[model samples]
Target: MQVDADSFLSGSSRRWVAHYRKNLDRDWQIPWSSGTALTSGEKQRIAASIAEFQRGEASEAQDYLGKSSAFSTVARDPDFHAASILFVAEENAHAALLLRFMQETAIATRQHSFSDVVFRWLRSIGDLGWSSRVLLIAELIAQDYYPCLRAATNHAALHRICDKIEYDEKAHVRFQTERIARLEAGRSDPAVGLRRGLQSVLLCGAIVVVYLEHRPVLRARLSFGKFATTVLRRNRRAQRAINANRRCM
Candidate 1:
């Protein structure tokens, strides 16, 4: 029998719904609330990054929901549904927060087309299974990308946002880790293993592409080579950690 939504809305689902409602209702006080000074270029860079992050997050949410729908019969897990809802809601909240921040600061931002970049990256990672893609992307965001963002941002408000984002991202990494473990425990297909390997490669490649594209901006505002090197090193370290943890289990 297909699990009814109402029936599944127990245990974790109930707790998650409560958490989501609280998050939706709570007034998020902007840290670094002062209207601090910033250069036009700095503001532009911040705006662009925020826009890109939101776009990427939306893509992730759509992909997750699509995959979850397909796997629901096999998975039959309410926790998965609840987690997906939480992920989507969080991404939406992030987009809203960024929009509000830009509006409040009076920052004018022109949307630059990054579709080509996104499509090419996705195509390269297309061989990977969805579960692997999730882990690879989460690890990249949590360990490599966010640190670069944190290091590059000088504005107090921006840093505060990034700090909060980084914390959330770390939790996302844990979520991915647990999900992957559950998948591996239940499914042992060689195809799935190969897909995961391909995903890791593609994820690393995408990180390089992002670093290169932002190199000029990063160089001027922050230490260019230093930031890139730190991110790459962190990426490697995170991958190793994930692998080691998996092996121990």
Candidate 2:
């Protein structure tokens, strides 16, 4: 699901649909039989770290999908709705994969988490722009988070699961970024600036909360500073691309 810049920037939901359909074909064939290698302490630590994220990923997005009709004018991509459906399905697939890994490792699933609740609320606000922006933050965080999750484990199944999820998340980021840029294409400069400012604040807040919640997993690969810097850097690049897309429109 690692889309190229040209394809991702093309703003063609047809391409997105094709990409998602093709992505669904990847089995990963995770070796569920490769029993976990984690110790009792490791299981407890990772379960606490990953449960919230798994819950967040599983958060239903029926509202977001329904609200996507608002994108008809701004997006105008004939296949946009189909792509959106596929995208949501892909996310749910990630949740299921995580759940399987968790069951294998004796990690319990979370019914709720504070951050997940807040993020779910943000996406339920009946505004496509806000929803896309909020989702983008989660997707960007996953770029770094999944690798850390993989590194934190020696379990083969977990590694493969992380690899699959990380791949899909990259495409999800691109998909959301494209939509956000398109949605803001004709907005006033000050309006765009204001929203971007708010998005920055939101991103920063989410990073702090996530780092606090999953520092053990993240510390496997990135220090706090490194993690923050990486996510911020990606956000800047995404913002620039958004601006670029707006200009072209």
Question: lDDT scores for all predictions?
Answer: 0.54, 0.84
The runs of at least 3 residues in candidate 2 whose Cα sits more than 4 Å from the true structure, single-residue gaps closed, are 1-11, 73-78
lDDT of 1 by residue, 1-249 (tens): 224423532343455546556656655456646766567766666556655654554435455566655554455655666666676677666666656556666754445447444643563443223544544464454454555555555666666666666666665555555445434543455654675576557655655666676553454444645555665565555455545444533
Worst 10 residues of 2 by lDDT: 1-10
- True-structure RMSD, every candidate: 5.6, 4.2
What clash count goes with each model? 0, 0
Where is model 1 more than 4 Å wrong at Cα?
Answer: 1-28, 44-47, 108-112, 115-135, 150-153, 186-193, 220-249
* Residue-wise C-alpha lDDT for candidate 2, range 135-217, written one tens digit per residue: 99999999999999999878898899899999999888888887887677667999989989999999999999999989999
lDDT of 2 at 242: 80
State TM-scores per candidate. 0.69, 0.92
Candidate 2's displacement at residue 125, Å, is 2.4
